[model samples]
Target: MISQNTIDTVFETARVEEVIGDFVNLKRAGSNFKGLSPFSDERSPSFMVSPVKGIWKDFSTGKGGNSVKFLMEHSQFTYPEAIRYLARKYNIEIEETEQTDAEKAITDVRESMYLVSEFAKKYFHNVLLNTDEGQAIGYSYFKERGFTNETIKKFELGYSPETWDALTKEALGQGYKLEFLQSTGLTIPKEDRPFDRFKGRVMFPIQSMSGRVLGFGGRILTNDKKAAKYLNSPESELYHKSKVLYGIFQAKQSIAKQDNCFLVEGYTDVIQFNQAGIENVVASSGTALTPDQIRLVNRLTKNITVLFDGDAAGLRASIRGIDLILEEGMNVRVCTFPDGDDPDSFARKTPYEDLVKYLEENAKDFIQFKASLLMDEAKNDPIKKADLIRDMVTSISKIPDRIQREIYVQECARIMDISEQVLVSTLAQLIQKDIAEAGKKQKQEQKPFEVHRNQKPKYTGYSGGDPEDPRNGPPEDYPGEPGYPEQQQVEKIDILYHLERKVIEILLLYGDKTEVFEDVFLRNNGEGEIETVTEKKEYKVFQRIYLSLQEDEVELSNTLFRDIFTGLIAFYHQNEKFSLEQYLMRLQPEFAQEVTDILMEDEKVTLHDWEGQNIFSKGKSESISQYVTETIMSMRWFLVDKIIEELKSSIVSNPKEDNMELLMMVMDYSKLINSFSRKLGRVMSRYHT
Candidate 1:
């Protein structure tokens, strides 16, 4: 377990901007930093980091929290791992007591695997720099490829000896578990013994977005015809090739800064571009580019320029990736190297200025690139030209943005010498077919869930009688109560949702502030006279809200809002003071993010500081007593209105003998609702008036 003091120290020392800026490129936006959301694909910047609050919110995904939560969310690190990462980054010493054998045994399996991979990465890197064979072979090979010493170390280049058991023996000798090593794919296990997985190869460690070594890619130095040229670690707990992009850890900042990413096809291509002064690049590592990988870049930028190898095969492979990028709503540009050259070779041979100029001048939009490449094949053949136009329309249809799709269609029509109306009609047909197919797929996916839900017992909570039978109306002698049950599930507009949400939001934001409330109660005087007595009561905001809800037996309908309210009440009972950020630390990430959204949204509306904005006739903070009363009363009014509507509906639906009783019930409920509305109107005078 992490010591509380150590956690506090880490929190105090770690700055939100500094911690997150290591991975995301943040630009100043007033007091906060704004950038593209790392959690989702977005073009404009919706991710905000507020250093003053020590919290970050990704409005795109509704994921927000302090520095620790950001690490946990972005890197998939466990709580302790994220905490330790911050501590290490901020140079804070952890002061936890040593774990016992039982405790150590209970450590997370994935974390153990990560630790084993990290150890192997460092071990392999050290061997490359210090060992005799590594210096002679590995270092020589990297140098021969035109990589500088800085590039070598920046990528953590490494080597493993040809000896079968070098890494295995070293890892075992260092007290690391064999199970973890095998799970990380660092050691290949056999019946009698285990051997190293990347023996006799130079290693390139693949890192997560946060720079944690997840696995490795090894290149065989020898010219062995039968052996594979390159070998990557098998998929393990920590590594999924399709979901990870090579060099993302190093390239995310540059990608965000440039507002563009150069897509390449190899690890060497990414490194070479970075070495040649273009740092915003990532590679598919020789695998087919996937949507998951494209979304990774989409989080940083909306523009991607794919670099091809200047061959027909490379252009064909590169074209396949353009639709995937377009599907993510990203702009696709294509640039090809000179004949007989690829990204790595071009970057190595060309000067930085020339390379930059070449890319800038040659990069063409996907539509233009396709038209230029295919025009030759359809030059004099009208039949082939029609096919080309259809192919372009298919690519255009993949684009999610309507304006972009239209623009591409216009450009394609002009290039293919086809009528614009013809292209538009064809595009429309394809899009309609696409939507129909998508609808079918969606229904197929939802079918199983629908079946399960239908099989389960659903409760309407009706006391008696079939609700569909008009003969059985509401009970004539029904006691009209404030907390009345629903007659049947009606999906009418519920105003109480927003009111309940407001109450919860207020409690979360100003729950610790002391406020004086006026409480009125009925009492019997000695002369058998009923008198209204008023009492002045002092309670914290959270205390007042909790007690009021408890007294009225009111539970928020939204489960998320109810959970947050309950948690706040419980927290306030234990601690006299409340801190919003600290409260967030104790809750789960998803719950904490919801609370953060509520709090931040309230701030955006100038919750407590609305007075200077001239939007409120009265200061909210100064009129705390009235504010709380108004919120609760508004909620009560909504409930009364709901009941009134239900009663009216029931009376109209059931033309039975109990019509007189139901009418009286409706009148009485109407009177109550009118009283509540009057009270609510008075309290909301600042806005309503």
Candidate 2:
């Protein structure tokens, strides 16, 4: 467990804007910062970060929370992983206590495999840097390839020794379990005999977006005719080749800053670009481009420029990747080098400025590049030219945006000297075919519903343990009750649910501030007569809200609202000076999400911009006391009205002779409702007593 002092220090020292700025490009918007949503692709900025509140809200996707939650959602880091990342960013020393036996035993499988992979990465890096053979072979090879000592260390390049059992034995000797080693594909375990998987090879560590080592890709130094030149770690718990992109950990910040990514084919291309002082490059690591890999880069930026080798023959093989990028709604441009140069060789030999200028000047949109490349093959041959036009139309049809697709068709028609109508018709046919194919596939995959009479329905959130047990049916939910509205949403414009959410919003925003409140309530005067008593008192805003609700026997009807309500109350009760940032950081992700949604409600409204138009709007904080009083009184009246209607229903159902008591009860509640209306400054009153 991390010590409380360390967590507290980290929470205090880490600024939300500074932490999120590493992954996102934020521009000042009034008191907040706004940027394109990382969770979605959009031209407009919908993601807002409020440094004052220490929270971020992505209006596009509705994912809002503190800094730690952003890391978790963006990079898929676990809670502990997110915390450690923040600690590293803020330079706070993490003090973790020794784990008990039970704690160690319960660690997750993927996390265990990550530990083994990390240890292997360190062990191999040590061998490369410290061992005599490694310095002569692995280190020398990197240097020969024009990699600096700094670059080698930045990428954590390493070497595994030639001995078959070297790593396995060292790991076992160091008290690292063999199971995790085998699971991570670092060692091949056979009949209690294990050997290093990447033995005698130069190692390249593949890391996640959060910088955790997931696996390794190694290349053999010597020519062993029977062996593969480059061998990657096998699929395991923590590594998925199709979903992982090399150098994303190092390139994410640069990619976001540049608003573009340079797509490459291998690990060296990524490292060489970085070494050339050109960051914002990631590679697919020899695997064909996958949608998941594109989506990974999509989270950072919506523009990708693919750098291909000089050979024209290889260009055709990459066309599928271009279409995939287009299908993901990204703008993909292609840039190739001169006859004999690739990104690695060009960057290694040319100056940084020239290389950058070349890319900028030569990078053409995918459509233009394809049409130019294929025009040479189809020159003056009418039959081949028709095929080329069709091919261009097919590529254009993959684009998701209608305007871009239509614009490309026009460009294709102009480049091919074909009729615009012909190109548009071909593009339409290809697109219709794609839609038909997709619909057919969906139908094939959607198997007919199976009725398994003996199978019970699954309830993921059910606390009733056994589904097979007859007593464990569904949750005990009451939709008709006042305190539970989720089963039946009561958030209509005329309903009281909106008032419940308003109370929660106020508490979250201004709960710690002291306020004076006056209230009128009925009490027996000790003479068999009821008298209204007026009392004025000073209390914290949260205390006033809580006491008022408790007196009326009312609770927030929404589950999420109720959680935030109780959680905020407990947080305020414990701390003297409330820290909204610190409290938000401590909340569970779901609770924190609801809290930000409530607090940022006003920021999302158009009225917040009235000041910019020279038409100023009233600020809610200026009249918070009156606002709280009116909201609470209105809520009480709404609930009492429901009770009066219930009493009326009783009188109508049972002949009026049996409902005299109910009539008197309605009259008493009616008087309270009229009083509440008067307190709210409303002229018209109902059910006058």
Candidate 3:
């Protein structure tokens, strides 16, 4: 177990913005920062981080919590692991009591996988740097490709030795299980033997977006004509090639800062570009570009510059990727190397400024590039020329943004010697075809359900029934009444709204208020009523809340009440004058959720965001606080009134007023109602100004 002292230190030192910034490209959005959610594939910025409140919320996923929670959710780290991550990031030393062997044996599977992968990375890196065979093969290969020592180490390039059981044996000797090694694909198991998977090949570690090693890509050096040129780790619990973009872990920050990503085809291309000072570059690792990969880059920047080799096959194979990028609503530009060179060779030959200038001058939009590449083949061949035109139009039609598609269509027409009107008409037909396909797909998705034979059409909760008719659920009794759905709903809404307003009021108005409630005497009890205050229902609620607040407890059991309650807890802890405007500025999503929950529950709420004139008035801190107190007191009085009414009905039914217990209950109910009414009046008068 982690000590309380460690948890507190982690919370105090780990800033939400600092922790999240490592993975996300956050841009200032008003007082908070907003970015694409790392938790989901989104094009727009819906992930919000508030440093003041020390919490983050992904509006798309509805996941919001403090820094520790974000790390746990994003990295799949356990609580202790999250704490350790923050401790390492902030340079805090952790001191823990020794654990027993039995305790150490109980490791989480996810963490175990991470540990095995990390161990493999270190072992491979050690082989490349320190072993003679590794230096002669792996190090020499990287050096021959013009990579400097610093660049090699920065990328953690390595070699796996050519021994059958070298790694498995070493790992087992070091207390790691062979099962975990095989699970991570670090070791290949034969019928009765096991061997290192990447033996005799140079290594490239593939990392997660958060920079943890997940798998590897290995390149074989021998000229065995039948041997494959490159090999990659199989899909494991930690690595999915379809979702992983090589070098993203290193390039994400630069991509965000520059607001662009440079896409290349291979590992060397990524390294060479970075070495040439173009830091925001990643490789697709020879796989066809996927929507998942594009969305990953899209999270950092909307602009992508695809760097391709000058070879014809490479260009033809990559054309499909351009449409995919466009479909994702990304702005893509294509740049090819010289006929004899690729990104790796060209980056080494040209100066950084000259290379950047070359890309800027040569990069063409996808539509124009496709047209220019295919135009020569179609020249003077009417059928082929018409096909080329249709192809360009089809590509243009894939763009999701209408204005962008129109602009591309205009450019395509000019390049292909076709009329803009003709291109536009063709695009319209393609769009209609797409819509029809989509509708057909929707119908196919709905085919599994059995149609109801004699169903009465459902009425939504908004359809208010006749109030005078018992047939429509007993006249829809108001809140605090017996046997009414609306009454329970109203009670819930009143409690939430009032509690929030009271907390906010305490935070904004009386943050520094030191007024204490004095002990009051009770004539019937002889002793002062204050001594028995601990047992009173209202006082018990206050006491529970007060102790929780003092313990730095912030999370409210009710999701609807959490944000306001948390804000109140923070306010008490800060010891500074609180500002409602600033608080709202920071936690807009939480506040919005709370407001929506309240409004959606009750058919009639006492206070809206505005007053009777539809003007913004009651939402002010003072007005809201007064309204909350009124609502709570009114609810209490209403409950007492219902009790009194029930007792009177019982007495009338009996005809003889001889029930002493019933008489006491009625008196108590009346006294409570009168007290609550007086308190409600005083609270209203307090806000009458």
Candidate 4:
């Protein structure tokens, strides 16, 4: 119930490009900006944004709308949430209509969860910066690790107090619910008592790409024998560990700009890299890599460098994540620090120049890294060495890109001292085995359903009867019946689709074309009495259609043709001289929906990227205006053609050449139809080539 004025202001102030740019890396293309589709896994750019029109279109998925729609689709934000987000971004004050108590109650649950999460972030941050225990422990720990005050605050590093129930009591006192606290995993419940979950740990807030605090990761400082060093919030409605990446909110821009990402294992690793002047780094928070996490980075960059601790066991365990990255078609490289150092320690010990230089010099492609690491363990043992080669081949087979896979095979063969042919043959066998196993599993899953259908045979394409009439009983005698008339029915559907498209195209291309009808008589004169000798039938029809529209007092200027077309025939009975531009300008949403429905009903039509061809100014006002005009003209011709066909049928049925009234109507309709057809034909002639 935000005031209409507030909504308008938000829309006006929130530039579509600026709003979308925060999440997407957009590059200029003609009059629009083009980028890889965030909604889909696309390698090339198909998502477009038109700043002038204030709309965006994802050509790959066919989703297009204004800025609000983009937020709703991309972030799963509700309409009000999108509006509120815009309001906050643009600093607009919102005036909302008062809601009933029941409505407010329903809203409180979701809003309360968000409020509680924000409150916890603030509380943890304040405790770290202001309190004695937080400073003495958490702050001191971070500082010792070479994290400056700015770095600590930038990452929102904080400390949780040691006392159980401290956060719980404070939150409850502030009118926050225990349920919400537990739901976000900030507090835990046990046998009639609840306690703060992250008590006595240094805090790292895990955030969504938009910077909302979804959850936290906390590291314990104590050396208690039973205590786990690091802990994170449990899975909740807002935070799914498998799908979230730590520090993505802060690192997305740098990742996009660099065209590469540095993946690490923990919060300190990320902070150290950022402090070392490398900003395109994020941590998986020590979990197994998930496709959701991969895609999050994939949206920003296609190249990833996984930084592993130098220890052999850690390196061996982390190699599996590299295969996952390859499977997603991302380019991956591996860099291991010296045996004693992790990313954090290594980055802290070396100067920024040296650290960056070391990464650039030492990072190896996944294939070579896997082979070299495995070869060392299998040294001088032929059987184990053979197994190592097979393992490397299997990993290479998972890569989706054929060229990349081939290159890896050659590299692997060279490194392992095997023939290229031998490696290729081994990869083929492994791939076939994988495919066969997958097929067997699928067949097994389908067996139960197949058994249930054994009693009744499923319909195949044909029956024993004559194919001429599919509905009729099969012909008992003819083994080869004439094929059912599918071709004819398909042709009819094609014609219908084509006709509608052609009509729409013409309207969108040339609806604004003007024509002069002069030296035309409205009435024919007889010897004794006055009679109307209607001019060209098409012209008269156009006049009647035009005049009729005027008589109805309908304003057609700036109206979207799709809407006015439906009402125009009726309006044509009274009015004339309705400008096409007026009809197009005022097109309502329903009309736009109808046009889209019709245009997209058949196979997708690719409107060539005029910008790429340097044909027009991208998303210019003139080009869009011309497109709308053509669409209207095309639709008008379609309607006129229908009218002409009906009138001709009427003449043949009644033999009404002598019936002046009938003749006049036929003449008028024909003239209008011809006039519209000629105008559309010219436009089609010009653009179709």
Candidate 5:
């Protein structure tokens, strides 16, 4: 078990911005930081980090938390694992208590796989450096490719012996479970015996963004006609090739610092570039570019420059991937080496400055690059030229930004010597077709989630036995009845949901602030005249809100809002000042995330400026009192409306001789609702029928 003292030290020392900034490209926004969401594919900057509060919130996914929580959510690490990761990043010395069975079990199957992979990486590195076979074969091959000892060691490059079962024996003898080895794809299991999966191959360890070993990519030395040249670790709990980018662990900081990423095709390309003094580079590891991988880099930077070798055929084959980057709403440029070199060989031959200069000078925007490379092929053939123009239009259509699309269309028209109008028209058609197809796909996907009641509601006679009573018969279209639309019910629930959440948001943001409140009462001591007296009193914002809620006996209907409300009330009474980090530490991950969403909702307003709009920035310290009162009155109004609804429902379900009692109660609620609307600065007709 991790000692509580060590956990405390980690929590206090680990800065949320520093820890999260390693993986995300965070820029200063007012007092906080903002960046593109690491969790979603969004072009806008919606992810925010508050350094003072030591918390980060992703508005796109609605996930927010502290340093450890960010690691757990972003990397999918368990609680203890996330704590340990933060501990390592900050160099905090961990103090562990006595070993317990429960603590051992916390390193789950996924972690076991990670542990096994880490062990394999170190063991293979050891073999490559120390063993005779590895030295003469694997070490020699890497050295021949111009990999220095420092580069090899930094990347944890390793080698597996030619002999079968060599790694398996060592791993088993060390008490690492064979099941985990097999699961991580380090050892291929057989009924007869297990053997090393990368035997006689040089190893390349694939790491996640936090520098944890997720998998490996091995390159075989000998050109065995039957065997594949490259073999990657299969999908496992800890390793997902599509979502993991090679060398991201080492390149993330440099990528964020440079605000651009160099995407190559192989592991060697990344290593050689790093060795050549370029650190912001990663490889797709010989797989097709995926949206997940693109998003991985999208978090760190918005620009990706694809590097290709001199092989024209190979470069042409990779041109399609440029569209993938564009589809992710990223700026893509292309760079290619001379006829004799790839990134590895070119960097090896050139000096550092020259290498950097060449890359900068040669990188061309996507439209220019695609046109120049493909124009040669369509050379003077009228049929081929027309097809080439159509292809450019199609590629332009994939870009999500309309302004960018227009710019690229103009670029394409100028380069291809075609009319801009023709290209724009073609692009429009392609986009329309895509929209139509997407609409059809959405309809197909929504069908399963549509209302699925298997039977009709049973109709019963009203208490007065009136057959014509509306409550006794189903309407032409009502919720839960066949053919009834689901949208009305959804809208009704959403109204109350927003109202409840607004209360919780107010309490969280302004509860600790002290404000003056006003009270009015009739002053009469059997004097000549009974006059109204106004009294002013100072109370903490929470006290005023609580008193108002207590007066009505209002309880939040949503489970999350109720928890937040109760917790906030208890916390405010117990402590003088509210500490978001301290309060969040005491809640579960789900509750903590929701509470963070409420607290950080105000931060969203500052990231964007509104010159003439007064819709947001309502919870600033200067305006806390009025904002609190207005929010409370709004909730009271909603609750009064609900009470009226319930009373009306009660009257409809049962017939009364006079109905005077319910009618009077509804009338009182109506008057209260009008009063609330007046105080809230809204007309009565706006909130009341």
Candidate 6:
């Protein structure tokens, strides 16, 4: 367990913007910072970080929290792992409570795999830089490829020794588990014994976006016919080849700053371009580009320029990826090197200025590239040219943004010297066909399950009818028919979600403010009938909200929200002043995100000028007492309404005399609901005017 003192120190020292900036590129948006969401693919910035609150919210994914929660969500770290990571980053001394042996035994498997990979990376790198065989073979190989010493070390280039069991034996000697080693693909297990997977190959470490070493890519030095030339780490929990980009850890900052990314095809291509002073580049690690990889780039920038080799095969490879990028709603530009060269060779042969100038001068819009490439093959043949136009339309249809698709169509029309109408019509047909195919595929994937009545068990002497009988269902006296209870439960959950959230929001924002509230009571003044009395009572925001819910014996329906509410009430009982920062620090990551979202929702709304658009005319803090009372009343009214509906359903379904009592209860609840509804309406009416 992390000590509370250490957690406090970490929160005080750690800056929200600084921690999130390590992974996302945030720019100042007034008092806050805004960036594209690292959790989702989006063009506009929806991720906001507030230094004052020490919290961040990604509106795209609805995940928000303090700095520690951000790390946990983005890095998939456990709570303790996230705390330790923040402690290290902020240089805070961690005073931890000692755990038992059993507690320590349940350490996270993923973190262990991470540890083994980190050790393997260091071992391979040390071997390359210090050992004679590694210096001679690995160091020499990198130098031969025009990579300077600084570039090699910057990328953490390494070499595995030629001996089969060198890494495996060293890891076991160091107390590292063989299970972790095999899981990371650092050591391959055989029937007899385990051996190093990358023996005799120069290694390239594959890192996560946060720069943790997940796995390695190794290049075989020998020209043996049976062995593959290049091999990557097998898919593991730590390394997913399709979801990762080669230089994302190095290039994410530059990609965000430049608002563009250069897509390439190999590890060397990325390193070479960075060495040539073009920093915002990532490679697909020699696989077909995937939507996951595209989303990774989309988090940093909305524009991508794919660099293709001038050769025929590279051109074909580039064409296959263009549609995927377009479908993601990114602006894609295509740049080709001189026909004989790839990005690696070209970057090596040219000076920095010449290389940069070449890309700037030659990068063409994807539509233009497609038209130019295919026009040559079509060559004035009317039939072939028509087919080429249809092909272009197919690519256009893949685009999710209609405006971009239209612009591409117009460009194609101008280039092909054809009417825009024809191209537009063709694109429409292709889009409709795509939608139909998608719907068909969804239906095929979701086959309905057939439930047989004979499979159900029959219960004896139950008030409700037999389980297997379709018509005899629940007894008439039970809660309305079969589906009514489920429908009512769904309605209650949906209603309570927003209502409970509103109450929580009120307490979080203005919980410490003291306000005057009107309380109604009944008193007898030496008379037969009791006289109604209205008394003014002063209470803190938190006290009023807590008492209102307590008075009704109400608890939130959602487990996470209810837990947060219970914690808030407990804290209010102890502390006179509520501190959001301190509260967030003590919160568990799962619930902390929920609190952060509630706290940051208003800030984001204000930042985007949505608050001033007459959408929510009543400010939450304008009339504190009224706001709290209305919110609590709204929830009470909703709950009462739900009860009335359930009681009415029962009264109609059950002919028993017990229903007379239920009908009276429903009548009283309806009267209370009406009174509350009218008061809420009056409050809303004040806002509208």
Better of 3 and 6 by lDDT: 6
Give candidate 4's root-mean-square deviation (CA, Å).
Answer: 12.8
**TM, every model:** 0.70, 0.65, 0.60, 0.62, 0.65, 0.65
Please provide the root mean square deviation of candidate 1 (C-alpha atoms, Å).
9.5
Q: What is the lDDT for 162 in model 1?
A: 93
Q: Count the backbone clashes (under 3 Å) in each candidate.
A: 0, 0, 0, 56, 0, 0
Cα lDDT of model 4 by residue, 1-689, tens digit:
78777877887788888999988999886666878877666787877777755667777767666667777667656567788999999999998778898977756765687789889988988988999988899889988989999998899888899999878998999999999999889999888899999999999999888778889999999897787899899998788999999999889767865779999999999999999999989999999998899998987778999999889986787788887887788999999888899999999889999998999999998887888899889999999999998889988988866667789999998898889999999888987886688897856764643423213212223322333222232222323313323443344334444544444443433333343322222343445333323232223333433443455344332234434455434433344544433332233434543443332322122234644566653221234323333444554554555566556656766894666676677677666656556655655554444
> Model 5 RMSD to the real structure?
11.6
Model 6 poorest ten-residue lDDT run: 456-465
Tell me the spans in candidate 4 whose CA falls farther than 4 Å from its real position. 1-13, 16-52, 55-83, 90-110, 440-689
Badly placed stretches (over 4 Å) of model 5 are 1-65, 69-81, 87-108, 190-192, 235-238, 440-510, 513-516, 520-533, 546-580, 586-689
How well is each residue in 458-480 modelled by candidate 5, as lDDT tens digits? 33223232222333344333356
* C-alpha lDDT (0 to 100) for residue 395 of candidate 6: 89
lDDT scores for all predictions? 0.79, 0.81, 0.71, 0.72, 0.81, 0.82
In Å, residue 518's CA in model 6 sits off its true spot by: 5.2
**Residue range 248-296, candidate 2, lDDT tens digits:** 9989867875789999998899999999999999999999999999999
Which tens-of-lDDT digit does each residue in 365-450 have in candidate 1?
89999988877778888898888788889999998667677888888888887899999999999989987889978667545434
Stretches of candidate 6 off by over 4 Å are 1-65, 69-81, 89-112, 177-183, 188-195, 349-354, 440-506, 518-535, 542-577, 586-689
* lDDT (Cα, tens digit) per residue for candidate 6, span 1-689: 78888878888889999999999999998789999888666789988999999999888767788888777666656567777898888778889677787766554677799899999989999999999999999999999999998998889999999999999999999999999999889888899988999999999999877778978999999998788888999999888999999998889767865779999999999999999999999999898999999999988779999999988655755687889998887889999888789999999989999998999999999889999998988998999999989988998998876667888899999999999999999998998888788896755643332224332211112223223232223222334435456345445556677888888888789998999986745455685334446678999988888888888899887677789888888888877678888777777766786788788877766557675686653566778887777778788788788788768766876776577778778766766766676667876665445
Clashing pairs in 1: none
Task: Name every residue pair that clashes in candidate 5.
Answer: none
RMSD of each: 9.5, 11.1, 13.8, 12.8, 11.6, 11.1
Predicted candidate 6, C-alpha RMSD = 11.1
On the 0 to 100 scale, the lDDT of residue 14 in model 6 is: 91
RMSD from true fold, candidate 3: 13.8
Q: What lDDT is reached at residue 453 by model 4?
A: 21
After aligning candidate 5 to the native by TM-score, how far in Å is the CA of 472 from where it should be?
Answer: 46
**Residue 159: error of model 2 in Å?**
1.1
